[model samples]
Structures are given as structure tokens and as C-alpha cells.
Target: MKHNFGAGPCILPKEVFQEASQAVLDFNNTGLSILEISHRSKEFEEVVVETERLVRELLNVPQNYSVLFLQGGASQQFAMVPLNLLPEGGKAAYFDTGVWATKAAKEAKKIGQVEIVASSSDKNYNYIPKGFEIPADSAYFHYTSNNTIYGTEVFEKPTTSVPTVVDMSSDILSRVIDITDYDLIYAGAQKNMGPAGVTLVIIKDEILGRSGRSLPSILDYEPHIKAGSMYNTPPVYSIYVSMLNLRWLKAKGGISVIEQENIVKARTLYDEIERNPFFKGTAAVEDRSRMNVTFVMENSDLEAEFLALSKERNLIGIKGHRSVGGFRASIYNALSITSINALVDAMREFEEKHK
Candidate 1:
């Protein structure tokens, strides 16, 4: 069996892919392919409506919260977020956790003032700086929910009185969360939901008009909200696949149940990493990510050998990210505990061989 550990566009439920394959050939009894189905057609509209509905139910989002499925990835929302949220000359606060957090801060900086309230970069982003003060007069406090590269997660979100926006591109639906607590949250569908080409945005309707910024039709959330995500030709196929994945999640007992499994899976792998003699974890003990576990060999030669060994064993994407040279085992929600166990067992077997 193949063990997948890729960071983004990570593993997904087997049933989801199997059902999605059927849809691609014959969608909703339309006889036409899912890809060729007109975006504005009834079959497609039904998919859009159900997908948005599933998102609301999964997130427990209130009526005050509006969901939009739009083109471009989470990177696009990095810029659109500040443009649509930050008032003129208003200062937005950001916590520098990893590459994505820095990218969001940089995009916001071009349109409004941004303050790096706190950063763990000095420690190579191995931990989240706790108890750092967020400015009282700031427009909003923003943070990346999970650091994919460094394998750190906030685990618990930071509290702020101001409007809070989270980049949940890698962590959304991994567990149950209080959706009402934040003013805005966005995630790219590729990792957890479906494929690329769609980005999911959930915003509090009350907080949007406060920015007083005129946004382009595509960038503005209002247009998409007003039309129920039908303003333009939507990513119908991607949305359909996302809908299937959401249904799979719901059928398997929703976020609460899946969260328990996620904790177990992460614990199983982390325990192995800590106990194993040859490999060592990279992140701080408290800030380890449930989504990505990054580690390296204590001996440089063993690191190369580990990569080759993993490849020979059919375990792929277990190599470290380029910026930080170490292997990252991305345990997204869809990655089964069995896959993680295989990796850990491989680590043990390799440790025995190396020693």
C-alpha cells in the first residue's frame, strides 16, 4: 500500500474519490460529464447549494456568517482580506508563524498598515509566541491556524476583542471549532475539501461593511454572497467533489468524531518520533501540529538513508521541506491512522538498521 504524506493537496477519503470518479463520468443522471456540465445548469446549481449547506452544517456557522466559494486560492484571499476588511489607515495585526503567515502580512501591508505583533521566527517558528499583546486599536488580528512547513500549530486559537481572521487553509475541518468566535475564516479546498481552483471564505456579514473599501466585483464578498455563490461561473466540478468529501465527513460522524481520530493519529506518530533513537522532532513539544509532523535524523548520513529507505518502502512525500531540511509527515484529516503507523513502523525498522 502507498503511504501519502504530501503537505497540501494531501490525502483524502477513499470513498470520496471513488464516488467522485462516478460523478465525473455521469453526473446526477445528466448523462453529461461533471466537467462539461454548464455551471449555471440545474444539476450544477444543486451541487453548489448542497456544498454550501454542508459547509455551514459542518462549521456550525450562524446566520450572521456567510459562505462564499470563489476562484483563486487562499493566496488571493491574502490580498482581498485586507482590501475588504481594513479601513483606511487602519492597522491590522498578524502573528508570524510560518511562510503563509508572512505572505498574508505582506499582502495586507500593500493596502494597509500591518504590525507583526509577535513572531517565533527567532526559534525558526518551532513554537507560537504565547501571551503576546495584540494592540487595542488594531483593525483585526490575523493568524495562520497551522504552520505546514515547520509543523507547528496554535492548537488553541488566540483570543482577541477585535475582529479575528484566520488562514485555515491547512487545518479547517480537522476538528470542531467555534465558528462564531471569528469575524472571518478562509481555507483552500485542495488540502481537506477537494481539489484546487476553489477557496472557501466564511465571513461575518456585520463586520464586512465596516472596512469602507470599494472592492472589485470578484474580490468583494458581497456579490458572491448576494447571489448564493452564483455571481460568476463557479468551480462546479471542484465544488461537486468538495460536496462529496463533506458528505463523507458527515457520514463518518462529523467533525467531533473525526477530531478524536485525528488526536489519536497524531499522538501515535509523535510518540514514535519521541521514542525512536535515530529521528528527532523539529517543533516544540507544546506546539506540535496534528496536521504536519516534521522531524529529522540526528545523523546527517542517516537522514539521506532514511529518505532512500522510505522511497524503497513506497512511503512518499516523507522528505523535509526545502526551506527547513527535514521530513514532514502531513497527517491531514483524511490520512488514516494506518498510514501514519506504517511510517512510524518504517522509522523503527530504519532505526534498527542504522544502529
Candidate 2:
């Protein structure tokens, strides 16, 4: 068995992949591949509708909000949020925690003024910035809930009177969050959902039209909402797979149960990092992410050897991001605790052999 810990386009449930595979060859017994089906067909329409419904149900999204299954990844949302929410000459506040957060702030700057209320860049993003105040006058306060590159997370929503926007690309559905707290939430479906190509956006209806600029039809939220996420040819395969995954999530006792499993998985790995003398966690203890656990060997010389050991044990994608050279174990919802234990066992074996 292979243990997958890669960050994006990460592991999904076996059953979901199996179901999706069959759909690719023959979707819903229609004899047409999901890849070749028309987006306007009733069959595909049901897929889109059911996907949206699952999102609303799982997230407990408020009645006032609208869910959209968009094409572009969360990167597009960096611009879309500012385009639709940030008015001309308006200012927005950002919490710069890592690479993705900084990129989001940079994109918003092109459209309007962006104030970085707080950031952890000074320490290579090993922790989430704390005690920062969101400017009341800003259009919206944007933040990334979980920083995949840095292995840091903001567990609690910031308390701000202004509208709140979050890039939850990595952490969505891993835990339960009050969806009504944010004016807008966007996530790339690659990590915890299903696969790449589909982006999920949930917006409070009242938040739209605040930006007075005339956006292109594709960029505008109103058009997508009106068209029911079929504004153009949607990512049919990705959406269908996501729907299957969401259904699996619902069947497994929803977010509450899964959140507990995630907690246990994180604790299991973090405990090993803390107890083992050869390894040390990189992120601040208080802000460590439940989804991605990052650590480094105490002796720099042992890093390469430990990585080789991990590979020898069928532990793949344990290597960290290129920007930050260390091991990152991304234990998303579908990543079984047994895989985490296998990683832990590998680490112990390496330590005993070396010591």
C-alpha cells in the first residue's frame, strides 16, 4: 500500500476514484463518457445540482448564500474576489501567512489598495500572525485558513466587522466551520474534495454588486449564479467526481465525525515528531495545521538519509515544498490513520538504525 502525503491533487477515498473511473467509461448508464457528455443535458444538470446541494448541506451554508462550481482554480479567485468585491479605489485587508496568502494580496493590489494587517513572512511563515486588527473601512478582509506550504493554520475565524473572505483551498471539509461567518469562501477542489479543474465558491448573496466596476461576463458572479454554475462548459468530470466524494463524506457521518478522525491523525504524527529526538516540527505548536504536518531532522546531514528511508517504505509525497526543504505529511480526510502509523513506524526504524 502507498501512503500519499502530497499537498494539492492529494489522496481521495478509494470508492470515489472507482466510481469516477466507471463514469469516465460510461456515466450513469447513458453509454456516453462523462468526458464527452453535454453540460446542458439533464443527466449532467443533476450532477451539478446535487454537487451544489451536498456543498450546502455539508458546510451548513446559510440560506442567504449561493454556491458556485467554477472552472478556474483558487488562483482565479484571488482576482475574482477583488474584482467582484473590491470597488475602485477601495482598500482591503489581508493576513499574509504564506505563499498563497501573499499571492492573493498581490493580486488584490492590482485592482485596489491592499493593506497587510499581519504576516509571518519575517520568520519564513512558521506561524500565523496574531493580535492583528482588521481595518474597519476595508472592503473585505481576506485570509487563507490553512497554509499548505508552511504547515500553519488559523483555526478560528478572525473577529472583524467588515466582510470576510477566505481561500480554503487546502483545508476545506477537513473540519467543521461556521460558513455564515464569511461573506465569501473559495476552494480548489484538488486537495480534500475530488480533483483539480473544479473550484468551489460560496458567497453570501448580499456581498455581490458591491464592486461598481463592470466585470467581464465570465468574471462576474451574478452570471454564474444565474446560470447555476453552467455559465459556460463546466468541468463535468471533476464535478461528478466531487459529487461522489461529497456523497461519501455525507455517508460517513458528515464533517463532525471526520474532524475527529483528522484530529487523531494530526496528533499521532505530531506526537512522533515531539517524542522522537531525531526529528523536530517546524511550525509553531499553537498554530500547527491539522491537515499538513511539517518537520525537519535535527541534524541537516540526516535529512537525505531519512528521505531515502521514507521512500524505501512506500511513503511517497513526504518531501516538502521546493521553497521550504523539509518533510510535510499532508493527512487529509481520506488519508487513513494506518498510513500515518506506517510513516511513524518508518521514522522510528530510521532513528533506531541511526542512533
Candidate 3:
């Protein structure tokens, strides 16, 4: 069996893949493939509705929020959030933890004035900044909940009086979050939720028309909300697969159960990284992420050899990103504790070989 740890467009449950594969040929016994069905069809419409319902149920989202399945990934949300929430000439506050957070702030800058409340650039984003003051008068405060590249996460929402928005692409469903605390939360579905092509946005309804600037219908939240996420042809197959994945999540006892498993999986790996003399974790202990665990060998020369051994052991996509060139084991919802064990076993084997 192969263990997959790719960051995005990453692994989904085996059952989800099996079901999605069948749908590609025949969805729900319909003659047409899921890909071929009209977005307006009753069957496809049911899929979209169930997908939204599952999101709300799993997250305990309130009725006042709109759950949208959008086209562009979280990158588009970087623009849309500001376009909808940040009015012309208004200022927004952002916290920069990594590349995605930096990009979010950069996009907001194009729309209006943006203040970077704090940043971890001094430490290469290995940690989350603290004690930063968010301007109470800012239109909104934005931050990325999890930094995939740096393997850091802000588990606690910062105290801010202004409206709060989070880019949760990598960690949206990995744990429990209070929906009432934030005015908006957006995530690219590729990581914990499902496949690529669909981005999830949960926005408090009152914030929809606050920007005041006229937006293209497609870019505007009102049209999509009014149309029930069918402003145009949606990503049908992606939403279908996402629905299946969400079903899997619900069947597995929801977020609270999966969260405990994730905690155990992350700790099991991080514990080995600490106990093993040959390797060391990269992120600060307090800021380490439960979804992506990053670490490196003490002696860099043996890096390539261990990578080869990992491949030999059927470990795939464990290589780290270019920015932080070590190893990033993306332990998303679909990756099992068994896979984490496989990785820990590999680490132990590498240590024995080195010793």
C-alpha cells in the first residue's frame, strides 16, 4: 500500500475515490455521467444542496451565513473577500504568517488600503506572530489559519473587534472552529474537504453588500447566493466528489472524532521526529500544525538517501516544498494513522541505518 502526503489536490478517502470513479461512468444509475449532467438538473441540484447542507451540519454553521461552492480556488477568494467586504477607500488589517497570508494582504492592497498588523517573516514564518493590535476601525481583519509551506497554524482566533476572515484552505475541516466568531471563512476544497475546482465560502449574509463597489456578477457574492451557487455552470464533478467525501466525514462521526485522530497522528509523527536523534522538527513547538508536520535531518547530506528509502518504502509526496527544503508530511483527513505509522517506521529505519 502506498502512503500519500501531497499538499494540495491531495489524497481523499479510498471509498470516496471508488464511488467517484463509478459516478464518472454512471451516477446514481442515471444514463449520464456526473460530468455530463446539467447543473440545473434535479439530480445534480440535489448533490449541490446536500454538499452545502453537509458543510453547514459538520461546521455547525448558523442560518445567517451563506455557504457557497465557488469556481476559482482560494486564490480567487483573496480578491473576492476584499471586493465584497472592504469598501473603496476603507482599510483592512492582515496578519502575515506565510506565502498565502502575504498574497491575501497583497490582493487587499489593490482594492483599498491594507495594514499588516504583524508578521513572522523574521523567523521565515516558522511561528505565528503575537501581541499585534488590530485596528478597531478597519473594515475587516484577515489571516490564514494554517500555513502549509511553513507547517504553522494559528489554532486560536486572534481577538479583534472588527470583522474577521480566514483563508482555511489547508485546515478548514481538520478541527473544530466556532462559526459565530468569524464573519467569513473561505477554503479551497483540494485539501481536507475534497478535490480541486470548488472553493467553499461561508459568509455572514449581512456582509455581502458592504463593499459598495460594483462588481462583475461572477465576482459578486450576491448573484451566486441568489442563484444558489449556480451563477454559471459549476464544477459538477468536483462538487459530487466533495459530497462523497463529506459523507465519509459524517459517517466517521464528524469533525470531533476526526480531530482526535488527527491529533494522535500528528503527535505520533512529531514524537518520532523529536526522539530520533538524526532528525529535528522545523516549526516552533507551540505553532506546529496538526495537518502538516515538517522536519529535517540533522545531517543534510543524507537527505537524498532517506528520500530514496521513503520511495522504496512506498512513501510518496513526502518531499518538502522548495521554500522549505526538508520533508512535509501532509496528514490530511484522508491520510490514515496507518500511513503515519508507515512514515514513522521509515524514520526509525533511517535512523538505524545511519547509526
Model-by-model lDDT, in order? 0.89, 0.93, 0.94
Task: Report how far off residue 353 is in candidate 3 (Å).
Answer: 1.0
The TM-score between candidate 1 and the true structure equals: 0.98
TM-scores, each model vs. reference: 0.98, 0.99, 0.99
Clashes of 1: 1
List the candidate numbers ranked by lDDT, top first. Answer: 3, 2, 1
| Candidate 1 structure lDDT | 0.89
Q: Tens digit of lDDT per residue, candidate 3, span 1-355?
A: 9999999899999999999999999999998889888899999999999999999999999999999999889899999999999988899999999999999999889899999999999988999988889999999999999999999999999999999999999999999989999999999999999999999999999977888998999999999999999999999999999999999999999999999999999999999999999899999999999988888889988999999999999999999988888899999999999999999999999889879
Each prediction's RMSD to truth: 1.0, 0.8, 0.6
Across residues 320-351, which tens digit of lDDT does each residue of candidate 1 receive? 89877879999888899888888988898997
Candidate 2 per-residue lDDT, tens place, 1-355, comes to 8989888799999999899999989999999999999999999999999999999999999889999999789989999999999999899999999999999999999999999999899999999877889999999999999999889999988889999999999999999999878899999999988899999999999999999999999999999999999889998889999999999999999999999999999999999999999999999999999999999988978899989988999898999887777799999999999999999999999889988
Best-first order by TM-score: 3, 2, 1
User: Looking at candidate 1, what is the lDDT of residue 119?
Assistant: 98
